[model samples]
Target: MAIIYPLQPRLSSTSTKIVIGLIWALAFSLAFPQCYYSVTQHYPPRTICMVNWPDDYGGKHHLTYQIAMIVLIYLLPLLVMLITYSLIGQTLWGSEIPGEASDHYQNQIQAKRKVVKMMIVVVMTFALCWLPYHIYFILGSFNKEIYMQTYIQQVYLAIFWLAMSSTMYNPIIYCCLNQRFRSGFRHAFSWFPFIKVSEEDKMELQHTQTFRMTRSYRTENTKSTVVRHNSTQHDDHTTVKLMKS
Candidate 1:
């Protein structure tokens, strides 16, 4: 959506909702198989929950699933983001937002630069956060000794926490980098005395709403004007034909 933000025929609320639902459904569906294949072993004191992975005599289901997940959930997304954001960055920096006043055009360009920078930071952060965990998973899968070391548990915990930290980084990035997001955050916590939500800051969100309404109104008005202009031309042609007859 952000990639083609300036384009026409954008997704409506209903379409967006359906897409969100489909994404969640696909994620859950893909995850269901792993859950089904998991095994719980009770070893007296501490029970271990693990995948029912195969060995020499068994099939390669677990290994295959792990590879698939690493590709689908990690590598593919990373690759896609890298490509799309690179294009977006190039477009943003290279192109000009024409027809605006000089100051307004400069401001828009700066805004685009900020947005691209923020998105790049987010992508890099996410990639870094998960790199160690994915590497550890791959190592452990191929080499059983990777999991046998004394410091292995500590290493796993650190990597797991790093991966989880990516989720926390995103909102903070948006709040710090985007004015509207910061404004919304301020509005949400207006009860706190220290966080002053000024009327200008409040207008940041309302401005978006007002802008959309105004743009739609302009579009409808243009369409009506075009229709009227064409109809008048047609009526003039009819009058000319009647006089000739």
Candidate 2:
């Protein structure tokens, strides 16, 4: 969206980049397993309480790791995204740019709304997909009995796939809702065997390109006009001085 839409926030500011880097580092550091002591050499039993521990460990560190993973990976990121998107949404819809017409402004607002809506959908999908996976860990961390149940392994497999499936949906979302991505997808598809790019696809890609070019020209033209007007006034003043002399 940032590539196609000029108005989209790119977060190119140095401070913002630094903050993002810090956040990513923190999340990554927190996600690493700190309780390697609790990890079994083999997988945990599907239906037994007969696990041998090297020491008289109470698995408190394991619970802490599980809680950290849930907070850092899922909850923390989700909260941050929600807040960021909310600010973006307010900026898009609340503020109006000068010289934009009512209809054009409305269209811009609608476009931003779509972008925000897409972000929200992505976040929600992630939450839903990963919910079961995290819930399993949370349950196991708090209740050893549930962790030792016969059906626990099967449940883990199910939630694991559910979480894994979220990664697959992002491309579909982009192709379906984003015009630039759709055009790019079509262009790429044209290279495949027995596939040809349609004229409409070509036109859509060209149209977006042309629109950007036109905007650049308009901005440059406005600056040129101001300079020309100042030059014209100076020329007139010189002519008057020559006539008076």
Candidate 3:
């Protein structure tokens, strides 16, 4: 959605939602077999030093499938995210809002830049976390001797956990990088005995709300001014026609 923001859309919201759902469903479906095998068959037995199950799970054909799944799930998404963010960064830096309120325009652009930065961090984190884990599997699948040593097995365990831990880091990143999330976290945890919402945070939240209200008021005022100008023109035209008649 950020990719096409502030522009007229060629597709409806329902179509966009359906397209997103279908893409995610397909990606997950492609990924289900590896998860199913790990859960139902085995959990990285020391014998195989990987998540192979049923004794023939890592057969030549299955290796091919796993390779494809890696491409679809990990690599492809990273590539697309990088491209999308590059475009967004360019657009944010290149475009300017048309108004006399240059300060407000710059503030809006800065806010968007912050959002893009957060998203880039997220995308890079995902790729960094999974790349090593997937490499371990790819090596194990093709070169059976790669997993023989105890040290290598330990390394594999570390990489596997690193990938699993990726899901745990995003909220922390958002909390640290995004003010809205910080304010939200404080509010959500305000009831806790140890958590304190600081005075600065309260002031920041109030300032944000005020800014939004001001923008809304300006928009409404502009619309009303246009309407009044049109009405005045119509009344003048009617008077002129009455005098001529």
Evaluated at residue 226, the lDDT of candidate 1 is 90
Each model's lDDT: 0.84, 0.75, 0.80
Q: How big is the positional error of residue 50 in model 3, measured in Å on the Cα after superposition?
A: 8.3
Candidate ranking under lDDT, highest first, comes to 1, 3, 2
Q: What count of clashes does model 2 give? A: 0
TM-score of each: 0.80, 0.64, 0.65
Worst lDDT 10-window in candidate 3: 41-50
Better of 1 and 2 by TM-score: 1
Residues 99-150 of candidate 2 have per-residue lDDT tens digits of 7588967766676677667777888888899999888877876677885689
Query: Residue 193 error for model 2, in Å?
Result: 3.5
Clashes of each: 0, 0, 0
Can you write out model 1's per-residue Cα lDDT over 101-185, one digit (the tens) per residue? 7887887888889989998999999999998988887776677677789998898999999998897999999999988899999
- Model 2 clash pairs? none
Instruction: Estimate the lDDT of model 1.
Output: 0.84
Off by over 4 Å in 2: 1-28, 38-57, 94-111, 212-245
